[model samples]
Target: MTKVKIASTTDVSSDKVLKTSANGKSVLVAKVGDNYCAIANKCPHFGLPLAKGKFENGVITCPFHGSKFEICTGKNVEWVDSFVGIPLPAIAQKMIAMGKSPTDVANFAVTQEGTDLFIDS
Candidate 1:
């Protein structure tokens, strides 16, 4: 397993997101209590960095297209109850479900350990 020591537990506060990049892909680090949770850094919609997006109730919205996703899994928040791989007529819907209108996910690998993060292939 690959591990990157990002920061200490004190560096982040509960409910706040600390974003960084590893392996050229966006990495989002969030502090919940004394532990850190890491996930993909970019929004599933429009490929916007999740760091630039807003977080609320464990969910985040893409700034580029108003698409929302769950911060932990990078999956669509499902406001309209749509599937990730499905395409809708609404542009905003597509963004939320697929991260971009033309949803072709560039797969990457990432993980976290003891407040540190790692990006592996």
Candidate 2:
């Protein structure tokens, strides 16, 4: 594994995500409280960039399809609910996945060195 320095600690504020690329892979670094988490910047559902997604309480909601993921663990929290308040049938939800199943986003291990942040990609 290669450790790439992506940003300074100050560059990522609490509850905010900083988008950067490491080793040719797009990464999103977020600071939740006192801990820092790093994950792939793309949504697993449709390969959409997650930089525009909403982050709250370590959960990121994809802007395109409303897929929610846990930032720290890269676990799938919710799938294909981007239809806002509208409730869709299970079959419709499955169709929105484009025949793909829900998958976790790729997460990178993050380490802090002084003021710099390094991620293993």
Task: Please report the candidate that would top lDDT against the real structure.
Answer: 2
Assess each prediction's global lDDT (C-alpha) against the native: 0.54, 0.85
* Range of the 10 consecutive residues with the lowest summed lDDT in candidate 1: 100-109
lDDT of 1 at 115: 50
Per-residue lDDT of model 2, residues 7-43, tens digit only: 9988998777889999898999998778888999998
Candidate 1 structure, TM-score to reference? 0.59
Residue 86, model 1, lDDT: 43
Q: Model 2, which residues run further than 4 Å from truth?
A: 84-89
lDDT of 1 by residue, 29-121 (tens): 665444455667654444556567667766665554555665555566543233343435565464445443433223233345665454552
**TM-score between candidate 2 and the true structure:** 0.90
TM-scores for all predictions: 0.59, 0.90
Q: Counting only residues 3 or more apart in sequence or on different chains, how many pairs clash (N, Cα, C under 3 Å) in candidate 1?
A: 4
Collision pairs in model 2: none
